[model samples]
Target: MTQIVQSLAEISKPYDALFCDLWGCLHNGVAPFPEAVAALQAFRASGGKVVLLTNAPRPAKFVIESLERMGCPKDAYDLVVSSGDAAQDAMFAGAVGRKVWHLGPSKDDGFFTEIPAEWQGQADIERVDFDDAEGIVCTGPFDEINEVPEDYRAKFLLAKMRDLPMLCANPDVVVDMGDKRIYCAGALAVLYEDMGGEAMYFGKPHPPIYDMARRKLAAIGGVEDGRILAIGDGINTDVPGAAGEGIDCLFVTGGLAHDQFGADQKNPDPELVRAWLGARQTDPRYTIGTLR
Candidate 1:
């Protein structure tokens, strides 16, 4: 029985910090949600630390740059941790072989070039053609808005035949890019795994990113496990990740699962939310219509 609260202020007192998801919770890829921004700023003003955890498939700096472009101020959160940063460490450590094929858009080229200084000298990664590559590194579709997971079946089959392991940076299947939902690297990873090709992940609901978040959290101020609360709209990522870490979760019903609760953005029917969450085998500590 998840408590459907009206706002974050009601239950935020017990928590010292937040492990917050970004995509659907903070911004819609086009712009920052004003209410969501206020909620985060309020949380920080109350002396709570906010770590913006995301599966954006790119390093944290790129995420911050995009936020700046969207006019989302830097004071809204304490830090940003990304799946791409974790995956980059693994890649340099040989999670996938050195000779890998890059499968993503031109905008994501920074993933290979803008790595952290620590991994710079140790990394000898090379992006080669699919046929000559030792493994595959997938950030996302070459054209996210125009492509679907099924569009890459032929290439996935070839990778399966060659037994090339895929390193998936993002684990989100689909996200609302303003008005349209677009497939992400996780969708491709799921299809690849269904085709018997191995796909490794480092994002939410996965242990690696959580470990990274905790380590980063320690740097600012180590919030005890019992005093930390996770907040997000991603039931798949936020709920499961918080549960796995043994922390409370606040599910924003208006994000990815907004369709399940109907059109009233500010008033989500609790029963519908319960039924849907029960179906997913998740029991988040709290639920709200939106972040504010």
Candidate 2:
């Protein structure tokens, strides 16, 4: 684990591009971190490309809209690649001509609006036969999955036994929803996989989203992969995902873990950060009090 001073001015050697995580590193889902926003703007003014890589379940447009609402200026980022966008890509890549059973909130339907006209809506899999259907797409409600009854689980398992592949739109197991740790698509996917189902993920900690972000960065004349930097707060998603892609990561404290472990108890302890990363075997390139 490395400890770097939290001074944006010290970043003299401007990176070619920056891949920043959305939730905890940039904002706490409610407001944009003023420092983070300023830093991004500074980096861009210095000719650095900024690409925001988010694990948000919504598509790029929705994510951008949300950022705008949260006070992050449009100029703060060059491109936004969301898990929701990756999910849409995965849906079309494998199941173009077939029908899909979408299991998610109503708002998530917008994600599939771009899909082929023939590949939409839910249907009985057993009656239609396995070869005819495309696959199961899930963009689960952060609040609903945990409350599901055992019967729903049994039914979903039966669907899996029929050899239907499941494409998980959001790979986050859970996210902070107004002080609650709600279930996410990845958690349900894990359960499905445990029941002998084949699940494909399309979000953070997964490679496709990172690949897309990299491509977008390259298009904007951003730095090559070696000079790119990833800033995130979640160890399970952002940190590991960036590290897996061989990009440098700057971990922000005071997100989910800070709340779970009591923020006031330990705010600026390098040893504590090291222990947290060490437990997960994810040593980030830098650790900071906050991304801002």
On lDDT, the leading prediction is: 1
Off by over 4 Å in 1: none
Model 2 misplaced regions, further than 4 Å? 12-14, 95-97, 115-134, 142-152, 260-266
Q: Which 10-residue window of candidate 2 scores lowest in summed lDDT? A: 122-131
Taken over the whole model, the C-alpha lDDT of each candidate is 0.91, 0.72
Q: Show the lowest summed lDDT stretch of 10 residues, model 1.
A: 114-123
Q: How close is candidate 2 to the true structure, as a TM-score?
A: 0.85
Residue by residue across 116-176, what tens digits does model 1's lDDT show?
8888678589999999999999999999999999999999999999999999999999999
Per-residue lDDT, model 2, residue 139, is 80
Point to the candidate with the largest TM-score. Answer: 1
Question: How close is each model in CA RMSD to the real structure?
Answer: 0.9, 4.3
Residues 19-102, candidate 2, lDDT per residue (tens digit)? 888776677677887888888888888987788988777789888888888888887888999898877776665542247777
Model 2 residue 141 CA deviation (Å) reads 2.6
